[model samples]
Target: MLTIRRHLVDAIVEHARKDHPDEACGVIAGPAGSDRPERFVPMLNAARSPTFYEFDSMDLLHLYREMDDNDEEPVVIYHSHTATEAYPSRTDIGLANEPGAHYVLVSTRDEDTHEFRSFRIVDGEVTEEEVQVIDGE
Candidate 1:
């Protein structure tokens, strides 16, 4: 299960909505081994496609360096799907490299509704997981 704060979830949804037709991608980093998402790092989707998301290689590298300096690890890796369900696509599965991270998908297919789902993708296998949102720290 992925245990996260309500505000963090809201931020992700808001970012997704802001990106609208384009897919929004980002990461929530926390202390190493914490499995707790405490920092929100919104990223630019290099692909800028409605059906796909790709973190800018340079930005991703910088993020990794920053995380290392802070002793942090990505707890939640998230992206938005503008016209599809909140589920991982084959590309997403194939790109999954963080076996310990929670892969979060937010679907903004409906104007008035959205779907937020979490999964574990390890070695090309995807498993849906429960999300528990709390009041916050």
Candidate 2:
């Protein structure tokens, strides 16, 4: 299961909605080996396409350096799908290099409704996971 705070969920959804028509991509970093996301780092979609998302190479390089300095790991990797369901695409599975990260997909196809789901992709296989969004105090 992917356990996350409500505020984080809201922030992610808001980002996806704000970037509708173009996919929004980002990462949530947490302490090494914690598997608990604590910091939300919204990223620019280098592809700038509704059907795809790419992190700028420079930005991703900087993120990794910062994470190394902070002793953090990306616990969650997220992106929005403008016209598809909240599921990993073939390209998504191919691009998932972080095996330990939760691949979160938020579909912004409808105007008011969204389908937020999490998945684990490893060795060309995908596994749906339960998402438990807890209220933040």
Candidate 3:
């Protein structure tokens, strides 16, 4: 299961809405090995495509350096789907690099509703997981 704060979940949804028509992508970093998402880092979708998302290469490189300096690891790797369900696509599965990270997908297919789901993608396999949103940070 992926245990996360409510506020963080809200932030991700907000970001996804703000970038509707184009997929929004980002990372939530936390203390190394903790698996607790503490810091939200919204990223630019380099692809800027409604069907896909790609983190800017330079931005991703910088984030990795910053995380290393802070002894942090990406606990959550998230992206929004503007017109699809909250499930990983074949491309998404192929691109999953962080076996330990929670892969979050938020679907903004409906104007008044959205679907939020989490998954574990390791070695080209995907497994849906439960998400427990808590009240506080």
Candidate 4:
């Protein structure tokens, strides 16, 4: 299971709504502990497609270096489901590069509300997990 912050979830929902008719992608960075394996630090992705998403390699690389410098790690990769359910697509499953990282999906198909879900994709198989959002500090 993944424990995301309430503020982060709200941000993602807003992003999804703001990017209506297109997909929005982002990165989540935080410490990983036994009790809270994944925490979220929402990031914006300038490069996104309506039907797909691709992290900007340059931006990602820069953020990676920055995170490393800050002694933080990206624990989750997130994207929005603009017109679909909060589930992984075949493309998303196939593009799972971080087996250890949580894959978060925020569904924005109804009422512009956010329904966050978590998953882990390994070897083309998707295993759904529970997501608990806690109030932010």
Give me the candidate number with maximum lDDT: 3
- What are the runs in model 4 whose C-alpha is more than 4 Å off? 32-47
lDDT of 4 at 50: 67
lDDT agreement with native, every candidate = 0.97, 0.96, 0.98, 0.75
Clashing residue pairs in candidate 4 (N, C-alpha, C atoms within 3 angstroms): none
lDDT of 1 by residue, 20-78 (tens): 89999999999999999999999999998998899999999999999999999999999
TM-score of 2: 0.98
lDDT of 1: 0.97
Better of 3 and 4 by TM-score: 3
Query: What TM-score does each of the candidates earn?
Result: 0.99, 0.98, 0.99, 0.85
1-137 per-residue lDDT for model 4 (tens digits): 88777777777777777876677887767654333333344455555566687777777888788767766666778888777898999999988987877888888778636678889888888999988889855
Against the correct fold, how does model 3 do in TM-score? 0.99
How well is each residue in 1-137 modelled by candidate 3, as lDDT tens digits? 99999999999999999999999999999999999999999999999999999999999999999999999999999999999999999999999999999999999999799999999999998999999999986
- Of the two candidates 1 and 4, the one with more favorable lDDT, higher being better, is 1
